[model samples]
Structures are given as C-alpha cells and as structure tokens.
Target chain A: MALNIVVCVKNTPSSLSVELDPSGQPKTAGVLYAINPFDEYAVEEAVRIKEKNAGSTVTALALGPDADQTVLREAVSRGCDAGVLVTGTEVTGGDTLATSRVLAAAIRKLAAAQPVHLVLFGKSTNDSGAGSVGGQVAAWLDWPGVLSVKKIESIDEQAALLWRMMEDGIDKVKVGLPAAVCTVKEINEPRIPSLKGKMAAKKAVFTKWTASDLGLKPEDAGAPGSGARVARYTAPAKRGTGLRIAGGSAAQNAAQLVDTLIERKLI
Target chain B: MNPQGILVVALNQRGQASPATWELLGAGRALADAAKQPLFAVLPGGTAEQARELVERGADRVLWTAHPSLKEFNDEMHTQAVCAAAQQLSPARILLPGSVAGRSLACRLAVKLQAGLATDVSEFSPSGMVKRGAFGGNLTAEVEFKSPIQVMTVQAMAFPPAARQAGRAGEAAELAFAPAAARTEVISFSAEEAGEIDLGGAERIVSGGRGVGGPDGFKAVRDLAHALGAAVGASRAAVDSGWIPYRHQVGLTGRTVRPKLYVACGISGQIQHLAGMSNAANIVAINTDPECPMMQQATISVAADIFEFIPLVVAEIKKRKGVPVAA
Candidate 1:
C-alpha cells in the first residue's frame, strides 16, 4: 500500500531581530520569514521516507497567513510532492490549542480523500517553542504521538520503531502506524533544493484551505478558540557589564581567574 | 465543572519525585496563597514516601495514584490519571514542571480538558498571567488563559524548591481511576554515557563550543570542570559537530542552565546558546575573539587560547587546593 505522509511546517522570523511595538507586540512589517529550522528536518525526513517507499508521496502543510505559502513553496522545493496552505484571519494569534485544532481539521479532511499513514512535525517551532501541537494533534486524531524522535528505525503497514532522545537517555518505542511523530534536529541532514525541484515548486499550484473550507466556524478557530493569550511582553532583564581581566600571558590570565574565583568563593 | 483550587502534577522518575516537582510546588504554593485557594498535588505512579514528602513540602492536599499500568513514564496513562484527578478536584490552575515528560503530559492534558497552556514559563502572577520567552528568547511574552482551567509548565530552576516543614502535615488521598490502553509501548531505555551531573542543579558549569576544535579538545574542558567540581556543558555547535553528546548541550534547543558561575571556553556565543546560560550569576568567557557576544556578556572576559589557558587554570586550582601537581 502507498503511504501518505503529511509534514507540518511553520514560517517564522528568519532571525531574532524582532522589534516590539509599544504594546510589546512584535512588529513584523519588515522582518523576513522562513521555514522553521526544525521543520526543515521534518520535510527532509518525509522526503526520505517517500524515497524509500517508491509509491509514497509527501505533502507539506502550513497554517498561517497568506505569507505561509512561502514556507510551503520552500518545502516543495526541498522534496515535498505537493504544498498546502491553510489560511484565515482567525488562524492568526491562535495559541497551540487552536492551531492544532485547525490543523487537525485540515488533516482529517485530507485523510478522507486519502488515508494519511504518517504525520510529522518539527519538535517545536522557533517562535513559540512550546512543542505541544504534535501531541495535541495526535489526540484529536486519536493516534499515538512521540516527541523528540531522533531516528526512525523501521516502519511498515503495522507499526513504527523509533528512537526518541530524552533528557537523560534514549527511549526505543514501538507505536502502531497512523501515528504522529515530532522530529528532532539530529534526525537527518536536510538536502538543499535542486534547480529542477525549484522549477517544479515555482509552477506548483498550492491547495488553499480556509477556516470555513475546513468546516471550522470562526468561534472554533483562531484567537476566539484559543485557550491562551499573550497578555503582555517584556524584555528579559539585562546582565551586569563584564569585568575584563588582562594579563601578560595565558598562564597569568589563568592565575588571575583563579584568584578571582577564590576571592568570590565561587570554586 | 466549577474550578476552585490550584493543582500541581508532581513529576516522578523511578517512583521518586523529581526536583522539578518541588520547584513547581513552590510556585504553586505562591499562586494558591495569593488566590486564597487550596494547593493540591497529584503524584502519578508515586510511592507513599513521595506523597508524604510532598505534603511536608507545602502541599495542602496530596492525591496519589499507583496504577499497575503506570509503573513507568507512560504519557497516556499519566495524563489519564492526572486528568481524572483534575476533573474530580476542579482545579482552576494546573502547574507542571517543564521537563520533557512534563511538557508532553501538559499538552495532552490541555487537549483533554480544553484548558489553556503555557509551557516553559518562568513566572506566574496571582492574576493568572504567565511570563515566558518566545522567538528564541529574543522576546518575552506574558500569557493569560482564556479557558476556565489554566495549565502551565514551569521552567526548570525557575523557582526554588519548597522547604520541608518539620511538623507540617496535610491529608493524602488515594486517586482511583483506570487508565486506558496506551497505543505506544516503551521497549527499553538506555542512559547516556555522560557522568551523573545534573546540569540544571549544578552551581558551576564549564562549557565548550565548536572552537574547542574536536572531540579530543573537550579534555581541557573536562579537566577544568573536574577541578571545580562542576558540571560539563557544551554549545549546540559542539553537540551538532558530534564532539560531545546532546546531554551536555546548553542552548535554546538543549538544556537551560543557570549556574552561579558559567565558564565558556572557546565559545563564540550564538543567541540560541546565550539564551540557555545568560541567567547565570557570573559568566566567564575565554576565547580568541574579544568582540564575540559571549565575551561582551560574560562577567569576566579572558581573551586567550582556551587550550593554553585551561591547563594553567586547572593547575592553579589544584595548587590552591593543596593538590600535588604531576611532574
């Protein structure tokens, strides 16, 4: 049986150069956005799986504003067979719960046409880094979810063997197929986009789905349905200016550091 | 359900409550006190001793479950057990430690309860607001819950563990619930080869970056750490280069450490790396490039070759400590 894999991607500010307005909201007018770094790994893993499974296809999906199409295009250029952009004003400023609900709805719609064998996500996004959506999506779909997966040992029609990198150790787990897998950066080295792939991506027609298109009412999506809200923003407190220690040689510097540590009783 | 009290899901490893659990309790106590609500703690698959310890540590009421299926850290079972307790207790706020397992459980619980969740939170206000870093720590956002039930995962070391009272006692109740069959099963767990050093709890740390050159270059770093009795840490660059394991990595995508003294050897601090250790009490940077961000942010900047400097530092420490130097 041909496998259907869906890779979720997010478009975030390319750099940490965010400018907060007076209300502490990020002013994203001039900031450039790119595919989240972790999602690159997800796309790569999906593409590799497709390559291994000759009849399989990889679909990259993103839920955001219209600009998110750029991320979908990037995913297609990297290796995804197709691109999907799920957009709506309600999708903006949604918390992980709302976002997962919307994405789950979209995935369910897609699964109706063709059953999805595997769902993949970056361990977390660079912006939120909450790393909650994958598990929540899995719950909505009633499938098992695994986070921080470093390696996919094997996968077949029945189940998948995975190695998840934990804080103190690695867990080897076997989850029945039709499961959600969140990938870590250590999983694989992502391939660069080829010219032929870029050409295909440029001409690719993205399947666009709005909240209504996904059968989600305004109250069931976006901030209205979000469980949490960012009430305010503040810059982290600054640290004290450092004391520069100068010495004639490396040994002298080392001696000075030792003295300072001893004086402060930090050692 | 009319939520009324604050609930803390005590995280346990091998039946012992994790240090992060106590930290969450400390935060929960404050929130409960300010709200004038009862502070309750739930221990999934925990022992009687662990439950008693939590009560002494400020939990007004302790709810524990030792379900047979919950012998280990199974997300589904743990989540089900905790949710069952929450559903019965009707907690207005649920707090968890922001560990790997904690976050996963918090997410699943949020989905089950339809509660608002904020993970990796550093602070919580009595008014139901949470402060957490976003956009790779470049920005901080204060979050609020829209749902009646609020869920949050506190960052490790963000709050000090609650102190145990000598005679303080609280009621301990057994939580009875049957867990659903888990779709995933853990085959085995293999601990990392790294030594037993809790980076989050360490007072002093010595971290190396890619500039350490190679895997063998970590020798000097390990030596310095050994002399100081400190934990060893690495930048994402070093970990990604395969010079060291991810367990030692200190960065946005890795462990966040707030040691009293952080010594950076041959590390040109990236923003992601700095986010992990910038909260340290004092930072020392030793690198060739003086203009690097790590140098600028360090409390003490030493512009020298770490290869040459670490040995002398180790020797000086050993000499000061009255240890004989090898010829």
Candidate 2:
C-alpha cells in the first residue's frame, strides 16, 4: 500500500543571536529565519521513506506567520509532495501543547481528506529544545507514537518498523498504520536539495490555513492552552578565565598542564 | 485503572530497574508530596514477584506489566500503557529522569496529552520554571510554563536520590498489557569493549581534544585513565578526525557525562565539549594555552603539555594505588 506522510516543521532563528527587547521577550528584529535545523531531518526522512516505498506522498507542514511560506518552500525543494502553512496571530505565544494542538487539528483535517500513514517531527527545536511538541501532537490525536528514532527498518503500506535508541542499546519497534514518529539528527543524514528541486519548490503554491481552518478556538492553541510555560530566560555563566599555557614546547606544555591538573587534584 | 495517582516509569534494562529509578523516586516523591498525590512505578518485565522490590525501594505503588514482547522495549506499547494510566489519574505533572528513554517518552507523551515538555533540566523550579542549556551550554535559558500539567525530563544525577528506607511498604498494582509486536528488531548490540567503563556512568573521566595529535596521542589519555581507574572521553574534533570512536566522543553530538571528577588534557574547551562534562563535580584542565576556555572553567588549571605531565601523573596514581602499570 502507498503511504501518506506529514512532517510538522517550524521556522526558527538561525542561532542564539536573539535578544530580549524592552518587554524582555525574544528580540525578533532583523533575526534571520530558516527551517528549524532538526526539522530538516524530519523532511529528509519523510522523503526517504517515500522514495523507498515508491507510492508514498510527503507533505511538509508549518505553523507560523504567513511569511513562513519561504521555509515551507525549502521543504518542498527537499522532495515534499505538498506544502502547508497554518498561520494566525492567535497561534502565537504557543508552548508545545498549543503548537501540537494546532498541528494536530490541521493533521486531522488533512487525514479526513486522505489517509496519513505516518507523522514525522524533529527531536526538538533549537529555540525550545523541549522535545515535547511531537509527543503532545500524537497524544492529541490518540495515536501510537515513537521518539528519537535512529533507524527505519521497514515500511510497508500497513505497518512501519523502526528503532529507538536507549542507554543500553537500541530497541526495535513496530507501529501499525497511521502512527507518528519523531527523529533526532542521528537518524539519517539529511540531504540537501538540488537546484532543480529548488526551482520546482519556488513555483509551487502552498496551502494556507488558520485556527478557524482547523476548527480550533483561540484559547485551545497558544500559551493559554499549554501545560507548561517558561518562567524566564537567562544567559549562561561565563566560564573560567580563558586561561592559556605560556610559551613552551609540546613536552613543556604537557608538564605545565599536568601540574595545573595536579594542583587542582583533577587527575 | 490503578488509583494510586501518578505513574512513574522506572528506568529498566534487561528487566531490572536502573539505579537511576531510585533517584527518580525522589523527584516523584517530591512532586507527589507537594501535590498531595500518590506515586506508582511502572515496570515492564515477566516477573510478578519482583514487584515488591520496587516498594521496598521507595515506590509508593508498583505496577508490573510483563510479557515476552516487553523483554525488549516496545515504546509504542509502553507509552500507551503509561498514557492510559495518566489519563485515568490526570497527574499534575509527569516526571521522568532525563535519560534517553525518559526524553523519548516524555516528548511522545506531551504530544499525546497535548502537554508541555521540558528536557534535560538540571534544576526544576515549581514556580512554573524550567532551566536548560542554550548556545550549546554556553548559556542557560530560564523558561516559564503556561501549562498546568507540566512535563519535565531531568538528568539522572541532577538530583540526589531519596533516602533509602529499609522497608517502606506500598501497594503493588500489576497491569495487564499486551505488548504490541515491533516491526524493527534488535539484531544484536555489543557494548564498547570494557578497557574503560562507559562514559555515561563513569565516576571519573579523562577527556582529550585536538591537542592530542592523532590516535597514537590517545595513548597518554588511556594511560592516565587506566591509572586513575577512569573512562576515556574525546571532544568532537578528536572523534571527527578519527582519533577516537564516535561512541567515546563527549560533546553536544556525543554522550553527556556527569562524573565526580573530570580531567581534560590538552583540550581547548569548546561550548559543545563543555556541555557534556560541565556537570562533573571537579573539572581539572591541562593545556598549554592559558587562555583556553576549558582552563578558565577548570577548577584547577595546569599550564603544561599533557605528554610531559601524563607519565608522571600515571606513575603517581599507580604508586598511590599500589597497582603496577600494565605494559
């Protein structure tokens, strides 16, 4: 059986170059936005699954400002079958729960149109790094789910075989049709899109929706609906003085290094 | 449905609770104690008799759902069971130790419950707060939760274990779960050869970075670790350059370690490398560059070359331990 897959992705600032404005919120001014790095893995995995199965269709979905269509197009370039953007100001300030609710609602709508065999997500976003969104989405949909999937062993029309990494080793797991799977970077090497693919993505018209589109109330999809929230944000403490050993040969350097370690009783 | 409120998933391997589960008991107990909640442990295995052991180990209640399919972790089934219980009790929060399994399940559960998740937290503040690394551990971001039913996955060693009581008896609730057969199966798993202990659980770790030239350079590191009865760790640079196996790498892309004592030799501490070992009780750095970031963070900084100091350090440890250095 051919599979239908949906990848939930986000557009985030490239790095920690974020600052809080007067309100002490993340400063978005002039910060460049790109596809969440981890989500790329999700897209890549979906495409790979589709390629392996031959008849699978992969849709890349994002929930953010309408401008995020640029990021959606990027997923298309990487071989997604379609692109979707769930946008609205009410969707803002959402924690993972709210985020998952919106995505889950959109997923439900999409599933009603065509069967979705699997839902994919990155392990976590660079901004939140909470790694909770995918799990929450799965719960909202009442679907069996897996996270930190490092490998996909088999994917037929009806069931999927995969592995989850553990402290001791990896465990093999099988999920029947219509399951959700989240992956870490270790899962697979995400492929870069080709120029031809990028051209195709640029021309593709992405579908747009909002909370109303998914039949969600405002309170059901943002901070008000989330189960957890950030209390504050702080900078990391500065590490010790950037100390460097003075002029010395490799042997001399080794000597000094050991002396320091010994003095600190480190070795 | 078990009435004992919250279900704490015990960290088990090959059908035994990892010692970390007891530590989780402390976290679980604190939450339960605060919320006036009751705590239960979910252990998957084939033994019913072993259920009492968890109670003895401080579980207020124990639930064992065992099957042959449960022999190896079937996350789908296990997660479903945990969620099934959560749905029944509706605990204010689901607490899991920030181990690999905990992170995986916590995220999956969040999606299921449409709840919020906090991962790898060193300390959790009940004031709706979560602290985690940012900029590769170069900074920490304090996060606030707007959600009521918070989900936190904490590091194993972040909190001390609850005081071990000799015989604190609690109810053991055996669960009936039919493990869903998994499609992917573990063919075989071979632990890294035990010349040194696993970095994750090592009491002492000696790590090296780019300064360790090549594979041959690891000899000094190995010798030092051997003398000190420690595990060996490497920075991403060393691993990427093929100086060490990726398994032995310690950094953002590698294993995060919390050893009692961490000795960094000739390593220029990058944020990524520091994230893996900053939690060590004692950090000692040996480097020629006094300005090296690792040195500044080192509780003790030795400005010397590792080659010169390693041999003597090895000899000193061997002499102190009265163990002859193996040729």
Candidate 3:
C-alpha cells in the first residue's frame, strides 16, 4: 500500500546576533538564515522511512515567506517527493500555537489528497527552542505524536517503536500507526543532495496556500492565534574572565587548578 | 475553583510506568501545592492499572486511555490524549521531568498548545524566568515565556524528591483515544544493562575523560570511585572513542547529574561536559591542565597526572575513611 509522509521544515537564522546597547536586550538584526539544522534530521528520517516501507512518498511541508524555500529545496534534494509552501502575510509573527494550527489545517488539506500516514518535525526551532509545534500539531490534527526520538526502533504498517533521548538515557516507546514524530540532531546524519536532485527541486513547483485556502480565519493564522508572546530576546550571560596559568608541567597545572577549585568550594 | 491544575504525562512500556514517572509525580506535587492547583497524571495503556501506583504517592487523579494500539508510545497518540486531557482540564502549568521522553513530549505539547516552554530548567522562580545552563554549562541563561500556560522540563536531580504527603486518592479517567499508525515500527530493542545502579540517581559520581589515556586508566578511576562509594561516569569523548560504554558517559550527549559531589579525573572540561554536571553541589577536578576550563568550574582542582595522583589521592581518602587501599 502506498503511504504518504509529511515532514515540517523551516528556515531559521543560523545563530542569534547579540549586542548590548545600554539595555540588556540584544540587537536582533544581522542574523544569517539557514535550514534549521535539526529539521534536516527530520527530513532524513522521513526519506529513510519512505525508503524502508517501499511504495511510500515523502513530502516536505513548510510555512514561511518566499525565502523559506531554501530549506524546502534542500529537502527535495535530499529525496522528498514534493514540497508544500503554506505561505502568506497572514502567518507573519504567529507564535507556536498559531503556527501549529496553520500547519494542521494545511496537513488536513494534504491528507484529503493523499492520506498522510505520518507527520515529522524537528525537536525545536533554534530561534525559540520552544519545541512545541509537533505536539501541538498532533493535538490540532487529533493524532498521536512523539518527540525527541533518537532512534527509530521499528516501523511497520501497524506501529512504530522508537527510542527517545532523555536527560539521563534513552526511553523505549512504541507508537501505533499514523503517528507524528519530532527529530533531534542526535537521531541521524542528514544526507547532502545530489546535483540531479537540486535541479529537480528547482523545477518542482511548491504548493503554496494561504490561510484562506485552508479555510482558516485571518486571526487564526498570525500573532492573535499564538499561545505565547516573545516579550524580548536577550544575550546569554558572559563567561567568567578566563584565568591563564603560568608555564608549568601537567602536574603543576593540575595542582594549581585544584587549589583554585578548593578556594571556590567547587570540589 | 482551582481551574488550573498540575498536569503530568506518565510514560510506560508495555504496561509498567518507568521510575521517572514517580519522580515526576513527586515534583508535580510540589508545583501543584505551590500553585494551589490539583494534580492530574496522564498515563497510556490498555488499562488504568498502569498509573494506579501514582495515587499512593500524591496524584489527585489519573487520566488514562487504555487501547491495544496505545500500548506503546506513539507520540501522535500520546500527544492527542494528553492534549485532550489538558484542554478538558485546562491546567495552568505542566511539569515534565527533563528526561528524553519528557523533553520531547513537552516541546511538542508546547507547540501544540502554543504555550511557552523552557527545557532543562535547573531553577524556576515563581516569576516566569527560569535558570537554564547555557554556553555549554559555563554560564546560565534566564528564560521567560510570555505565554499564559508555562511548560517546563526540570533537569534530573535539580530538585529533591518530595516525600509522600496525605493527598486525595488518584482517580483514573479513561479517555476516548487511539494511537496513530506510525510510519516506522520497532523491530527490536537491546540495551547494555549496567551492573551498577544508574548514575543519574547517584549521590556521588567519579567521571573520567579522554585525558585518562586508555582502558587501563579507567580501572584506576573505577577503583577510586569504588573506594569513595561513588558511581563511575565518562565524557562523550570517552564513550565515542569506545574507551567506555555510553552508559558511563556524562555530558550534554550523555547524562545530566546534580549529585552531592562530582569528581572529574583526567578530563579537560568541555562546554558539553560541564552542561551535564554543572549543577552538582560540589565539583572536584583532577587534570594536568592547570588552565583547563574544568579546573575553573571545579571547587577542588588538582594539577597532577592521574597515574601519579590516583594512588596518592586514593591512599589519602582510604586512610581518612579507614579503608584498605590497593597497593
């Protein structure tokens, strides 16, 4: 039986641009854009799932402005069968709740066309690291979802066994069929796209849809639909002024370090 | 009306709840009492018995959905059930222990609910700001969510486990649910069962890194830990290089610990390594690098070769504790 899988992909600024301007809030501009690295793991997992099941198709679904296609194209190159761009001004500045609702509506439409068997997302977005969208999407679509999956335990038509990375060790959990899963970087190495795949993506058309297209109200697609707000973004605290030890043998350095730790009551 | 309840999602395998679930419930009780909210536990299985044990601990209610298909953790199905319960109950806050499954589930739920989420939170003030490790655990970050429903995953060992208090009995609420068919299925799962207890719950940990040299080097570290009655730990580098089993690795790629004492032997502190144990009550370092970052973070830093220092330190500790030291 042919199965359809959708991987939610997003492009985010590679790293936060931090600056101090009197106030603690960092200057947020001048950030570079790249495919959310963890999402690449999701795309790779989706492609691998399709490969194993045989007769399965993988679609990369993204919600962003025009520039976001950079990640979608990257996914296509990695072996996604097609891409969907749910884009519009309506979704601008939407928080995770709104974002999930919009994506869930889009998935609903896609499901109508091909019957989506599985949904995948990265564990968290770099910008916010909120890591909520996948779970919210499962709720929006009323499906079972799992997050931070480090290893795919098993996959069959009936269910999927997975190992989730925790603060301590891995937790073995099994999910029944038609589940949604979020991937973390520890899961797998994302494949680099071939030249042929790149060319194919360039020619492939992204199915662009707006909130109206998904029968969602405008308010339900943007900030008003969001569950949380970002009051401000700030830089992380500075490290302790680094201490340089004078020239010494390894033993000497170790002794000095120990002395310092003892003074600090660290050891 | 305490409309805002404390919600916890319990993870089970086949039908038994993992030990972490109890730890979470213990934490949940504290948060619930603080917030003046009821505590509800959600567990997935074919029967409510999977979560019955929580009632004896402090859970006011156990919302369960028993389905043959829901026996395993299908994220989609689990999320659906938990979200349904959350929506129905409208909890003001959700507490998930910062375990692998907890972090994953919490992140997904935050996105699903469009709520604010903080991961690996070591300290959370009543105010929204949370203290989390940043820059490889060399520093801390204060994260505040602007959302009404705050979702947090507490780091393991960050808070002491709460003793059981007299609370209402746990009531199991069966749900109308089913697990989504997963694209992948578990073919098999094989884990290396460590002969020793899990390090996450250890009171003291003695960790070695690449600087320890080779397999033989670890024997000394192990002997020291045994002498100290502490668990053994390893850095990611040691595990990746096959110097030690992954179960022994301690760092961002490994386990996070907040033991009473942590001793690093022959390991130069990497940002990732510190992230795992930065919260320990006291840290001791034994490395040749006087300028090594770990030395700066460690309260007790020793500048010596492990081969040379191990015998002396072990002998001293043994002498003080009135134990025999290996010659």
Which is the leading candidate under lDDT?
1
For model 1 the local lDDT of residue B325 reads 88
TM-score for each candidate, following the candidate numbering: 0.96, 0.85, 0.75
Question: Which candidate model has the greater lDDT, 2 or 3?
Answer: 2
User: What ranges in model 1 sit over 4 Å off?
Assistant: none
Q: DockQ values for all predictions?
A: 0.75, 0.39, 0.21
Model 3 lDDT per residue over A106-203, tens place? 99999898778789998766555556688778767766777768788677766677886543346676676677788765677788888988898888
Q: After superposition, how far is residue A102 of candidate 2 from its true place, in Å?
A: 1.9
Scored on chain A only, each candidate's TM-score is: 0.95, 0.93, 0.91
Q: Which stretches of candidate 3 lie over 4 Å from their true place?
A: A1-3, A13-26, A50-56, A153-158, A161-174, A184-187, A192-207, A233-267, B5-90, B104-118, B128-150, B164-192, B196-236, B239-260, B264-277, B307-319
- Model 2: residues with Cα > 4 Å off, grouped in runs: A22-24, A52-55, A242-267, B1-7, B30-40, B46-53, B67-69, B83-90, B111-114, B126-128, B138-148, B176-198, B218-223, B242-249, B304-312
**lDDT accuracy of residue B244 in candidate 1:** 90
lDDT of each residue in B63-155, candidate 2, tens digit only: 776666556555555576677656555666677767766776786676665556777777766654668765455456676654446667777
Candidate 1 — which pairs collide? none
Native-to-model Cα distance after best TM-score fit, residue A90 in candidate 1, in Å: 2.5
User: Residues A35-59, candidate 1, lDDT per residue (tens digit)?
Assistant: 9988999999999999998899999
How far is A166's C-alpha from truth in model 1 (Å)?
1.2
Q: Which of the numbered candidates is closest to the native, going by highest TM-score? A: 1
Residue A254 C-alpha lDDT in model 2: 52
lDDT of 1 by residue, B222-287 (tens): 999999998899999899899997778888777777788999998998999987888788899999
Candidate rank order under lDDT: 1, 2, 3
